[model samples]
Target: MTIAHQPLFKLCYDEPYLQGTLIERNNRFLCHVLLDGSPVSCHVPNTSRLTELLVPGAPVGILKASNPNRKTAYDLVTVEYKGTTVNLDSNLPNRFTQLLIEHNYFPEFRELKLLKPESTYLDSRFDFYWERESFLAKKDPASEPVNGNSCLYQADTLTENKFAGYIEVKGVNYVENGIAQFPGAPTIRGVKHLHTLMDAYDQGFDAAVIFIIQRSDAHIFRPHETMDPLFAATLRQAAAHGIKLLTASMVVQGKCVTPTLEGPTIDLNPV
Candidate 1:
């Protein structure tokens, strides 16, 4: 219930999740719950450890799937811990980042155009693709910086324009003492993303990875090297290769998400 004065946004599922108490996580993708003192099986949306959030008898919110033919009708989506609600949907981060870009939340990308989602490249799928027209700061009508001042160009003019090859979004849930860490478990897919991001950069197009902290507790974001050293090493190499890194700390207000507090530059030093 922490409030802020920045622009706000939220993602409401098909319907508000039904209140329930977490009986137990039966498996990585399933769980048992108590809704109104009756036992009911539910679906766990994410596969991460979520060690700090989910607990026996903890308050939870379950989403009811429309298809009644499914094994479990409800999908566990939200969990409350230490007075904060954490979103557990594994597929929501990309959508949330898309909305943020559309709203100009990141001033660096405010002028982005031709935003595309779910772009598939060679052996890899990215979250977004976009183009931005940038003109050289002209002291004269030449292709050079004019005392580091910029000028504008038409949308049709591709000269000096930057086409972003890919943008990958990562969701963060593991947090402690205002520090957010990623990859609650080892991730091979994540290592692939780093290589792809670097490849995109080498292809003469913009590329970056964005990490969205699903809870309000984290003040900064860092890689969980202990959990996945290979991903950490690849991430460092990707950074060295000029792959951009962006982080945002977002809060869940009831069933909605507000404009995130964009995190500072990442701490690449291995921990």
Candidate 2:
């Protein structure tokens, strides 16, 4: 999915955190400039991954989210500290969005009639639409209109209609040292999407959030509570309320992405 907002910092150099200190520690580096002025800290999710790109004395962007729960005012979302000024690899979450929509992992819903391949909406494009038909109560021959031939006749096609749905997909890649997990940090946006799906269900449509695990090591999916407790709570709520959550394990090497389902149906009903 597209970033709803822009970056807050340009680079990490001259940032308050590294103001007068020279790089002496093993973990610390003079990486880049933080011109976006977004309040930032070292403990944020996905931020640590940029260390490979944050070369000494380069330029990068820092965006801060206003979170009371955050230790620092900002969590670094992007960087241009590497050789190239633009880092396109930051869009991993957006790339696998379609795989999330089509497989009903998130119970993501969309109207089949309104869907087109690569159709863009809500800042992201989804996969194929999911459609299902629910039939009305069984028809009775005795209640049918009488035909002239003494045979009871009824309409073969019921007036009942089909249900439509829509959804956006996101790929999770912030697994640490090979452990596949979601929300390397607290994601308020993810919580918001869970709420959106719950609302969609109330509106008489099926909604889902599909997570495509790009690594082979992860055999199951679980909310990252340490990163974002609210997100985990919302996820449990979505399951209790009938929202569909799906996880697909995949093997990704280079540009190839293959699907492999290895878990039971995502159980949402409360025990």
At residue 198, candidate 2 shows an lDDT of 74
Give the whole-model CA lDDT for all candidates, comma-separated.
Answer: 0.76, 0.44
lDDT of 2 by residue, 1-271 (tens): 8754322211221222222111111243222233445323432234323333444444433433446685455333333321222221233433444443344433334323233343322333344333443212333546643223222123342332324444545455444434445565567777877786676566554566666554445544666666677887788998888776776554433223444445223432222
Candidate 1 steric clashes: 0
**What are the per-residue Cα lDDT tens digits for candidate 1 across 74-146?**
9888899877788888887888898888888876567765677876655777888666634222123544422
Error of 1 at 153 (Å): 21
How many collisions between residues are there in candidate 2?
30
- Candidate 1, residue 34: CA error in Å? 0.9
Off by over 4 Å in 1: 1-6, 133-161
Which RMSD values do the candidates have, in order?
7.0, 14.9
Candidate 2 deviant stretches above 4 angstroms:
1-162, 176-179, 261-271
